[model samples]
Structure formats: structure tokens, C-alpha cells
Target: MSGDTALVGCDFSSAPSKRKSIVLAFGRLVQDRVVLDRLERLPTLQQFGDWLAAPGPWIGGFDFPFGLPRELVEELGWPTDWLACIRHYCAMPRDEIRARFAAFCDARPAGQKFAHRAFDRLAGSSPSMKWVNPPVAWMLHAALPLVLEAGVDIPGLHAGDPSRVALEAYPGLLARELIGRRSYKNDDRAKHTPERLIARKDIVTALEAGTSRLGLRLKLSHAQRDALAEDASGDALDAVLCLVQAGWAAREGPPRWGLPEALDPLEGWIVSA
Candidate 1:
């Protein structure tokens, strides 16, 4: 990775539309600060894929699971290798994938309906196989194929474009570290209250102070800070959060990218988790 490379953070959507587009935060790491450059929205997956394919010397933190639970993949009799399993998983129709995952959940005990990757517990993220609520499985289904087709390098997972590094990122992990799960955003406009606004400001304050374990401060102009903290949906803020993780990875660099050295190839680890 070059020292002058761009850094990106993505807040992705499985089925994007005009109102619920995929948000991207573009920045660069300068010393210990991540300087927010601009924000862009892709209202279609085709655009997202095209953007991924663009010439890069960019490292990105994408808010989506790069792999599934080992137990789930094994029980489902899917391919074990990283790229092969992703291909197999991606080839199936969403309906079929949901059916398989639902069946897997049905067979398990009540409290343990979902099988989780170890990283899920570590990052406090939803199971990648979950088809509802957050619908992360659909996200993996929609996004990973594009990442693969773009030939972006996923450190400790896939090797392709060395300049375009992709790492799994969970914004909630960093948010929880600073705020302990205080709700900061919502898609439902009715639920966008002062409390959530305050939460966003608090997070921004913590990040500006470099209070998180990542030890990198955020540099935002007055307008940029307002844009991040004022968006009721939190999509923009989440993208910036992922950008912070991407900054951490870019700073650390190379084969590990701040990932654990012994990461399970099948269930890829999240960046900075």
C-alpha cells in the first residue's frame, strides 16, 4: 500500500433504491487523522460494482460480512475454501438461500436459532446468515460477487488488485466502544429524535478526540461534521465509521491489515475487530 493511497468506507445496501442508496465516505490518512474528503451515494448495485472496478490505490472498509459462519457453511455442505464457498453461496437464488438458512435455524434450539462466526461474537455483529432484520445475508449475496468481479484484494481472504484492498468492517463495534450502544440513527423518520442526534454528536466528539482504541482522530470541516451528525438515517456516519477502520488498516498495511494472523480463511475476520 502506498502512503498516498486513498481510503474509503462503505455503508452498503443489498437492494438499493433512490432513498436507500449505498453510501461511501472517501478520505485519506494524514498522520494520525482521517481527513474526510466527500461522500457519494450509489443508488444501484451496478454503479457500486463499477465504482469498485475503478482504478485504485484505495483501501476500503465495507460494512458487510465477507464470509459466513463455519458451522453454517459446513452443515449446509457448501464449499470450504474462501473463494469457492463465496462462488457457491452467490450462485444460489436469494429465495433458495433464505430457505436453506431458515431450515438450518429451524432445526436448532429456540435460543440458538442462528449459527454465528466467532468474529460475529467478537464484533457484536449479526450473523451473516440472517435473512431478516438487518438482512446481512442478502447483503453478502448482493455485494461480495461485485467485490469478487471487481478483483479487489481482500487481505487474508482473496488476492487480486493489490492497490484496491477490501476489508470487512462493522461500524457498530467502534460505535459501541465510544457510546455503549446508545442508538444513533434510524431509517424511520418518525423515530429520529433529539436523543439520537445527541448520540451522533457524542460519537463525533469521541472520534475527534481519538478516544477509541483505534487511536486515530477524525478531521471534519464544520459542514462535514454537521452532515455526518445531522443525517437521521446514520448511513453517512456509518460510512465514515467504516472509513476510520479502513484508515486503521491502511496505517497497519500488508498481509494482515490489522486482522488476526490466524484468521479462519472461511470465516474471514473483520478489520480492527
Candidate 2:
């Protein structure tokens, strides 16, 4: 957690989303301020795992669900063991899983399709019990094994490699603070308008000026800045946002629950697991 640790912000995708892949943004805290280091786009879960396993002094704040709600796991009788639980979760076909989850939501009263805890909205931008929104299911699928393989001890969840610490981070948590309801990114070429570019510039300026509540200061290279602006699409800029998140996580240090700790085992980890 001390030197050269990488802060990572992940832009997660919902299931069946080919657009959904883990984007790794690298950064470190210098003199209590966050600084951008590098950026990489991980196109596959396996590739992300490889990056996690790569040797380095790094702690990542990934945009993924780190835990599940205790109630859901208990009620459904799913395995409490972290790996086993995720294995079961990932094993089920997407359609079946969605159907079951939808049914569960339907059973609930209106305005409560998914159970929610107060912290969910505060941190993950989702109800604590939602399987979508932040897409905790996909987060679980992408992150669990990598942490275990890294040998981190995620207390209350399971033990794993100690070198790597993965925490749940939602970019929206930070984004909302700077630009509420303003779309800063769009993958659709048709929607890449001047308005969105202005939003991106605003975000970039705020980061450079250290205006965000996270107290992070983003440092971008000339090339990086040019790349972010030149590309009509916002993919590069989005990656920068993700990078800022990673920098914040590295500065914050490891999860209190343990390196490999489960977020909720049912509800999932929203911000920090």
C-alpha cells in the first residue's frame, strides 16, 4: 500500500454486453495527491486476471461488485464460500439467472423490485440487492479468482494471495459529484456530440484542478491529453476517469474486511470491500 501501488477504476458492463470489459487505469498517490500513471483496456476477464497476477506493488479499486447481500445468499441457499458461491453463480446460464433474479424481484412489492440497503445508493449507485445497475454479478465473475490467485486475504469472505488487494469502486460515485446527470461518455458514434465533449473537458479540468471531493489530482501526459481530446469517441476519456479511481484506491489502502473479503455475499461490495 505504500509505494507505487496502482489505483484502478473499472467501468463494468452488464451481462451479454460485449462492450463490457474491465478497463485498467493506473495511478499512484504522491504527497497525498493522486497522480495518473498509465492506462490499459482489458478486453477479456482472463486478460484482467493476468494483469492482476502480474508482479507489482499495487492495490486496485475496481468497478465491480465485491459482495452480495447476506439475505439473498441465505434465502437462496447458495454456497457461502466465496469461490464456490461465484462458481455457482457463473455456472448458471445468463438467461436462467436473469429469469430467477427477475422472478425474485417480481415477488417483491412495487418500488422494491430489488431489496436495498442505505449504503447501496450512497456507494454503488444501486440498491444493495440489485444484480444489475453496477453489475455485481459480472464483477464477481471477473474479480474473485484473480484476487484469490494473488494470495490476498479478504477477511469474512475467504483467504487468498496477500499481494493484491481488490476493492469495489463505482465511478458514478465520483462522477455525480462533478457533473450530475450530464453524460460525459458515449460509445455510440452518433451520440458523440459537442455537448459530450464539453462534459469530458469539464471532467478533465476538474481532475487537473483537484476539484473533486475525493481530493484527487490527476496528472495527464501531453500525449494522453491529446488522445483524450482528439478521439471523437469518449473511450479514452472514460479510461482516464477509471485511472483516477485507481489512484484514489491505492492512496486509500487495502480493504478493512481483509484483502479478499466478501462485500456482502449476497448484496455485494459497493465501494470498498
What is the C-alpha lDDT profile of model 2 across 136-238, one tens digit per residue?
A: 6655655665666766545335655555555566666666677777887766788888887888777777778888766778887877666676555555565
Model 1 spans > 4 angstroms off: none
Model 2 RMSD, rounded to 1 decimal: 3.7
Best by lDDT: 1
Error of 2 at 161 (Å): 2.5
Error of 2 at 236 (Å): 4.0
Error of 2 at 140 (Å): 3.1
Q: TM-score of every model?
A: 0.99, 0.80
Candidate 2: worst-modelled 10 consecutive residues by lDDT: 257-266
The residue-level lDDT of candidate 2 at 138 comes to 55
What lDDT score belongs to each candidate, Candidate 1 first? 0.94, 0.62
Looking at candidate 2, what is the lDDT of residue 196?
78
TM-score of 1: 0.99
